[model samples]
Target: MASSPLGRPTRGTTGTNRLRRNDRWIAAADAFRRAADPLVVDLGYGASGVTAFELATRLQRVRADAEVRGLEIDPARVATATAQLEEVRAGATSFPADLRVSFARGGFEVPLPDGRRAAVIRAMNVLRQYDESDVAAAWRAMAARLAPDGLLVEGTCDEIGRVASWIDVDAAGAPQRFTLSLRLADLERPSIVAERLPKALIHRNVPGERVHALLVDLDREWDRAAALSTFGATQRFLAAVSALRDQGWAVQGGRSRWRLGELTLPWAAVSPLP
Candidate 1:
C-alpha cells in the first residue's frame, strides 16, 4: 500500500470566493501562464473543494486549458471534494460542467502520477498549524515537485478573504518574492496584513525584523496619504504605495496592481533577520 499523506489534516474551513484574491494572483503568474502543461495543484484545499473550482474558473480565463488538482491529506476530505466535483460536472452546481478540476489525497509531497510535476502549487492557509521552523522543509518538499519553471505560492488569508499575504518560491525552493493583497474598500490600514502573514514570517513581525519595519512604514505612509482619501481609498492606497517605493522599499508592480490593493516586493526586502 502507498504510504500515508505527508502532512497533518487541515481545519477544513472553506467558503465561496474565500480565495478570490489568491486565484487572481495565480492567474497572472508566469508559472501558470507559461507552463507547458499548466497543471496547478491546490494543496490542502480545506473541507471543501470550492476553492479549487474557483481557481480553475479564474485560471481558465487566462489559459483555456488550465487544470487544477485539489489535494488533501484527509481521505475523507478528498471524497467530499470528489462528491462536490461530481455535482459540478452534473450541472447541479454553478460551475461550468467543462471545468477541468479534480480532487485527490496527497500532501506536501504532492504525489502526482506518471512522474508529472506541477506548474504551480498553491498552499494558502495550509501552514497555519505548522511551526515556523517547519516552513523551509515544507517549501522544499513542494517546490521539488514543481516543473523547472514552476512556482509555489504559500500564504494565508482571512475567512472572508479581505486580507491576504503570500511568498512565491521558485522550483529550487528559494523564495523569490513576497506579496500582500488587501481589500481596499473601507480599509483601515495596510499594516493589517501583518496578522495574515505566512507562517515563516508571522512571528518575525516583532520589532528588529524586516517585516515589522515594512508594516510600520506601510502604516505610516497610509497615514501620510490620508489627505488623498478624499479621492477614494484606491487613490489613497496608490499614493501610499508610491511613497513607499520612493523610500527605497524596492516595491514591485505598477499602478494597475496597486489599485487593486496589492503590494509586492523581493523576498529580501522582508525576509526575517538571522
Candidate 2:
C-alpha cells in the first residue's frame, strides 16, 4: 500500500525503551486481544522503528499473527526503519525471527493495504507538539482509520519513561478512559504525571478544570498515604488510588492493575473544559 501524507512530523526523539509503559498497556488492552484483524499501527513512531518492533514482539504473546505497521511522516525516518528491519531479517540486529513488523510512511490517515483499518493505533508522545485545540480533530482523524472495533491509544510520556498517561478512544470516535502509568520505582509523586498529561488535558491542569481537581486531590492523597510508605511505594499508591475511588473519583481498574502503579479513570473526569 502507498502511504499518503496526513499529519505533521515529530521531533523523532525516541530511545531503546522510551515507550515501554505505553506498549505494556496496549499489550494488555482488549483492543489488542480481541481484534479480528490483529493489525497494530505505531503511528508517528519517531526516528527509529524499535518501538514498533517492540510492540509487534510483545503483542505476539497475546496474538501470534499480530502484525505491526510503523507509520512515520518523515520518509527519511521510514527509510532508516526499513533498513533496520532488513538487518533484522539478515540476523544482524536483535529481533524476533518471525516478527511481523513493517515500515510505512503514513500519518494519522493510517494508510494500509486492502482497505484495512488498524485494530490499535498507538500514537505516543506524538501529540505533544500540537496545540490543545488540534487534539480532538487529530483524534477524530485517527479514529476514523480504526476498524469496527479498533482502538486509539494516544498519550505522552517523559523522556526516560518514568511518567505516562493515555486516553482510550473507541472505534466510534468517543474517548472512554484516561490512564496514568507510572514507574513507581522511579516516581517521586503521582502529580509527576502532570507534566506529561495528554494533549487534551495538559493546559487544563488549573484550579477550575476537572483534571486540575483530580490531580490536586490525587497529590493530597499521595501525601496522606505517606504513612503507608513503610510497607512500600506500591502499597502507598494502592491506598491513595483506592481512596480516590472511595471519594467518588471514578477510578477504573482493580487491585491487580493498581499494584503496578496504574490508575485508570473515565475520560469524563479529565476532559477539557467545554
Candidate 3:
C-alpha cells in the first residue's frame, strides 16, 4: 500500500478571505504566471477548501489555465472539501462553475497524479504546529515536489487575514525572501507580524536575532513617521519603509507593493542567528 500522508492534521481553523493576502501574493508570482503548467497546490488547506477556490478564482484572472489542488492529511477534511466543491460545481456557491480546483488527501509529500509537478505550493498556517526542527524537513518534502523554477510559499496569518508574513522557498528547498504584509489601516506597529511568523522564525524573534532587529527598526521608524499619519496610514507606512531602506535593511519592492502594506527582504537579512 502507499505510505500514509506525511503530516499531522491542522487545527482546522479557516474562514472566507482569511488568506486573501497570500492569494494576492501568489497570483502575482511568476511561478504561476509563467508556468508551462500552472498547477498550484494548497497544501494542508485546513478544514475548508474555500482557500483553494479563492486561490483559483484570483489566479484565473491572471492565467486562465491556472489550476489549484487543495491537499489535506485528513480524509474527512478531504471529503468535506469535496462536498463543498460539489456545491461550487452545481453553481450553488459563488465560485465559477468551471473553476479549476480539486481536493485530495496529501501532506508534505504533496502527491500529484501523472507525475505532474506543481508550479507553486502554498502552505499557509500549516507549519505553525510543527516544531522548529521539523520545518527544514517539511520544506524539503514539499519543495521536492515542485516543477523547475517553482516556488514554495510557507507562512502564517491571523484569523481575519489582517496581519501576515511568509517566506518564499525555491525548488531547492532554500528560502529566498521574507515578506510581511499587513492591513495598514489602524495598524499599531509593524512588529505585530512577530506573532504570526512562520515556525522557522517565530521563536527566533529575540535579542540579537536578525528578525528581532528588523522588527525593532521597523517599529522605531513607524513611530518616527507618526507625523505622516495625518495624510493616511499608507503615507506613514511608506515613510517608515523608506526610512528602513535608508537604515540599510535592503527592503525590496517599489511604492506599489509598499502601498499595500508589504515589506520584503532577502531571506539572509532575517535568517536565524547562528
Candidate 4:
C-alpha cells in the first residue's frame, strides 16, 4: 500500500492577502526566476482554496506561464478548491478566465504530473502540526521533488497575516535561511515573529537557543531605534536591523526588504543546537 499523505489537515485558515508577503519573497527568489518549469505548488492549502488561488495570481506576475497546483490530502478540500476554478473560468471572480492554476489531492508526496519537479514548493503552515523530529524527514520528502534550483518555503504566520516567518530549504533538503516578515504597523516588537517561527524552531526559543538570543537582541535594538520611529516604522526597522548587522549577525536583505518589515538571516544564525 502507498504511504499516507504526510500531514494532518489544517483548519485551512487563510484570508485575502494573507500570504502576499510570502508570495512576494518567492517571486524574488532565484529558484522562481530560473525554473526550467515555472511550476509552483501550494502544498496543503487547507479547506479554503483562496490561498491557492491567490498564490497563482501573485506568481503569474513573475512568470506569465507559471502554473500553480494546489495540493491537499483531504479529498474534500481538493474538491472544494477545484470547484472554485469554475468561478474564475466564468469570470465570476477577479482571476483571469484562463489562469493556469489547478487543484489536486496530494500531501507531502507532491503528486505532480509527468514526474515533473517543481521550481518552487511552498508548504506554508503545513508542518506546524508535525513533531519537530518529523520535520527533517518531511522536508526531505518534499525537497526530493524539486528541480535543481528549486526552493522549499515552509513556515507559519498568524491568523490575520500580521506576523509571519519561514525557512528556505534547498533542493538538497538542507535548511538554508530563515526569514521573518511582519506587517510592522503598530508593531510592539520585532521579536513578535517568535510566535510564528517554523516548527523546528518554535519550541526551541529558550534562553540558551540561538533564536532566543536573536529575539533578545532584536527587541533591544528595536527599543534602541525608538527615536527613529519619529521618522516611521520603516526607518526604525532599518536602524534596528542595521544594529544587528553591526553586532555581527549574518543579516540578509537591505533597506528595501527591511522597509517592508522583512529580515532574513543565514540558517546557521538561528539553527537549533543539538
Instruction: Please list the C-alpha lDDT of all candidates, in the order they appear.
Output: 0.94, 0.89, 0.95, 0.89
lDDT of 3 at 75: 92
Q: Give one digit per residue, the lDDT tens place, for model 4 in 52-92.
A: 78888888887898889898888888888878888889999
lDDT of 3 by residue, 7-100 (tens): 8999999999999999999999988899999999999888899999999999999999999999999999999999999999999999999999
What does candidate 2's lDDT look like per residue over 66-107, in tens digits? 999999989999999999999888878778866899998888
Model 4: how far is 197 from its true place, Å?
0.7
Scored by lDDT, model 3 comes in at 0.95
- As a TM-score, model 1 comes out at 0.99
Candidates 3 and 4, the one with greater TM-score? 3
Error of 2 at 262 (Å): 0.9
Candidate 2 has its poorest 10 consecutive residues by lDDT at 1-10
lDDT of 1 by residue, 1-274 (tens): 1268888988998999999999999999999999999999999999999999999999999999999999999888989999999899899988999999988889999998788899999999999999999999999999999999999999999999999999999999999999999999979989889889999999999999999999999999999999999999999999999999999999999999999999999999999999
Q: Which regions of candidate 3 deviate over 4 angstroms?
A: 1-3
How many backbone clashes does every candidate have?
1, 0, 0, 0
For model 1, the stretches where C-alpha displacement exceeds 4 angstroms are none
Cα RMSD of predicted structure 1: 0.9
Q: Could you give the candidate ranking by lDDT, starting with the highest?
A: 3, 1, 4, 2
When 1 and 2 are scored with TM-score, the better candidate is 1
Clashes of 4: 0
